[model samples]
Target: MTNDKKRWLILILLAFISALLLAITSTAISIYLYGNKTYTAKAEAAIVLGAAVWGEEPSPVFRERINHAINLYQNQQINKIIFTGGVGEPNEAAEAIIGKNYALARQVKLNDILTETESRTTYQNLKNARSVADNSKLNKFLIVSDPLHMKRAVLMARNLDMDAYPSPTPTTRYSSLRSQIEFLIRETFFYFVYLVFQI
Candidate 1:
């Protein structure tokens, strides 16, 4: 090809690469910033997204999320709690039930707690929780989860057309810098996937 044409082609390629990198960097920053944010508005219920259950109990990560929901309940920010998760392999107990029990032990009333033991992904969790919300005539919700997980969780909730607000757990088990970075990378990738594929 002519030198002029080759020069233009290289410039275009460089621009494209730069734009892609900038987009990714901005997205990561947005995710990080949003995760650290909290919303304290009152909602009809707080939907505690599920994480791994250790045997019959909540894993540290899951417990933080449950604890956040409990705090919301105690503060009267929400009137009900909806726990979501299906059974994880090698553990017969469902994540939702385990979360329910954890909340129950923490003094949350059984009458105010709901469980959907069929969701295995963030999308499914909110989708199933919306159905549960509908049956109970609950319209608004506070989506409770870890800080880094809030961005994706709230996105999925909004995509599901649910009136939801983010309420990330003040304390996260991913406390170390390395672990927090790892979680951020994982969340950023999933956020991209969900944005592009709506999955």
Candidate 2:
């Protein structure tokens, strides 16, 4: 190729890379900021996204989400709790069931809790929760999860046409700066991927 043509191509490539980086950086900032905010509005139910389950108990990360939902229920911000997750292995207990059991042990009434035990992903979580909501005549929902996970979760909920709001857990397992940064990076990439599929 000619010198001028080669130079122009390089410049174009550089510009494209720069723009992509800027977009990603801006998304990370937005996710970080948005996740940090918590919604306290009243809703029909608090949809708790599942995390890890340690045997029969909830993992620390999962416990926080369930605790946040219980708080919402106790505060009268929500009337029902919906837990969503399937088992990680074929014969293991589902994450949703584990969360429900945890809440029950903590005195959340059995009649007030619902579990969707077939979802293995965030998208599946909200999607399956929507079905439970429909059956129960629950309309609005507070989407509860870890702080850094709220942005993507809420976006997916909205995309599913759910009347959803963010309700991030104030206390998160990702407490250290290093852990938070790592979560932000992971969320940033997933958020961008979600946006792309949305388009």
Specify the highest-lDDT model's number. Answer: 1
lDDT of 2 by residue, 110-184 (tens): 999999999988999999999999999999999999988999999999989999999999888899999999999
**CA displacement after TM-score superposition, residue 197 of candidate 1 (Å):** 0.6
Please give the distance, in angstroms, between residue 19's alpha carbon in candidate 1 and its true position after superposition: 0.6
lDDT of 2: 0.92
- lDDT by residue (1-199, candidate 1, tens digit) is 9999999999999999999999888988888899888887799999999999888889999999999899999999999999999999764799999999999999999999999999899999999999999999999999999888889899889888899898988888988999989998899899999999999
- Tell me the deviation in Å of residue 102 in model 1: 0.8
- Candidate topping TM-score: 2
Q: For model 1, give the 10-residue run with minimal summed lDDT.
A: 87-96
Angstrom error at residue 126, model 2: 0.2
